[model samples]
Target: MSAFEPRPPFYLGIDLGGTNIKSGVVEDSGRPLSSVSIETQADLGPVVGVENLAEAGRLAVQQSGLKWDQIAAVGLGSPGTMDLSRGMLLEPPNLPGWNQLPIRDLLAAKLDKPTILQNDANAAAFGEYWAGAGRNTRSLVLFTLGTGVGCGIISDERIIEGRHSHGGECGHIIIQMENGRRCACGAYGHLEAYASATALVKRAHELLAEQSTRSSLREIPAEELTSRAINEAADAGDGLARRLMRETSYYLAVGAVTLMHTIDPDIVLFGGGMIAAGSTFLEDIRQHIQKMAFPTVAKGCKIEYAELGGDAGFIGAAGCARAAFGR
Candidate 1:
């Protein structure tokens, strides 16, 4: 049996995105005790981004009704390749000019508490494993389908951080080889090129332009079209929109099946804004995986929705910090 305390008073988790910063204080069981958010102002550059994130963390802890010293630690989730040992973010594509910033040390100095940093996808995977859909499962995979696809893999209750902490970057994994579309990452046939929310929007626009289709989506201005708008259209039974979603689902299923064959996880969880389209999106992907995955692996694994919603990255960051601090 384990000998850890039943719970801690509070811990801090921060989600640093290109557009916004969110932070929360959580009980040991993973429930949010308090939360706060602010604009990332990433255009202001890395210095401001770091300062804003640290300020968000401080505000979250203050709002949680706990003293600074009472909080155990802080965990931060960021986009980019991270050097876990050095606590540096190495040339993140989303945050231009943010090269080798010592995020962990900076945040720790600000808060006067230990801090740990991890890639957002990896943190989300751990969040799911610790307190979300992957709970009670020994191995799991999670994919966040947003502007781009982000993947997280947890095995034997441990988040897999391959050599150099670049493991589980499943979005970059090729699904269609040469015939596939070009990805934002400068690669052809990568899964995100077709399966991501941005890809869905692009496909929807292409479909609209190619046909005289009477989608409600067309009523909206072309510049206003988005994956969420298409999903709303799908919900309203727009055929063109439905077709776009189905195509996206098909490509996503192919990626999921590929991950299954490579990782053989016990469960696969899908989440992100795109998934708010609900079961139609999930069911289509499930159907494809059922048809394509190896029978043995398909039979043993289950597909489910991520329960943590947008908070998965924050919770996972906290869990990563706990792990880092040996708490």
Candidate 2:
């Protein structure tokens, strides 16, 4: 019944992060032809950052040796809550002064092409579902473990963008009812509060400061400690680091269990910079999920690491563009 059957040959995808804006030209088949990253310079303000992102898209097209007119559409994945239908980024804290920015229209105007906008986490989930870990399942939830937990819900191969266009925020699910760790959203007992990579580093720092722990983390300056350093320490058989992994993985497991019951997804995929801990990091989450989730769903679901790594967000945005336009 629809006139558009197959989308054009190439789509442009952009990922807007706090530190960098990533851009890539994705073939209709979902393979990335080329990618580029540029400093966001949020310090210079949001307009400058948006301009930089647009320029990065151009550079990516140039790098790919393609003409701008060859691009069918441009898609963007950005952080923070947004009114997706309106294209307004509503009060994203990471990029100060980004309130009510009509990112979709701006990018479209600047790029001189039709553009689509979505949350970065949701974009990553789309990428994985279309081409990465969720390709087989098509029904999956994505948890991006970054500074905070970013949630993406795809049920029956459809992205669930709710009435307010803010429906699928899986990170805000409250796991703690009583006294719990404070979340970035100013709540307590959130999955993000306990399970995010930032939470892991914070928990490690607390354990280190609470008492002397015989681990490499103690030798490093407090500010120098990061999830990566902690993961490396754990890999080297450090006691405190191992314990930290155990504790954090338990929290991540709890979050996974929550996602399982809520989404009933065929697979629950984990992504973001911190999952670099690999199997050791995932083993704990899987073990806990096995014990806690419903028997059948637990057996059926796959607790897997996202295959796309850091590039999922942009790739997913391209996937969304293809889906939205057709083909």
Question: lDDT of candidate 2?
Answer: 0.86
**Candidate 2 wrong stretches, greater than 4 Å:** 1-8
Candidate 1 C-alpha lDDT tens digits along 1-327: 344332574678998988888888877777776778899888888788888998998888888777777788889999987797788999888888888889889878877888888888998998888779988888999999998899999988888888898889998899887688899989899989998988988888788889996889889898889898999989899999989989888998898999899889999999888889899889999999999999999889999999988889888888777776735
Q: How close is candidate 2 to the true structure, as a TM-score?
A: 0.93
Model 2, 141-173: lDDT tens digits are 999888888888899988888887775687788
lDDT of each: 0.86, 0.86
Q: At residue 179, give the lDDT of candidate 2.
A: 96
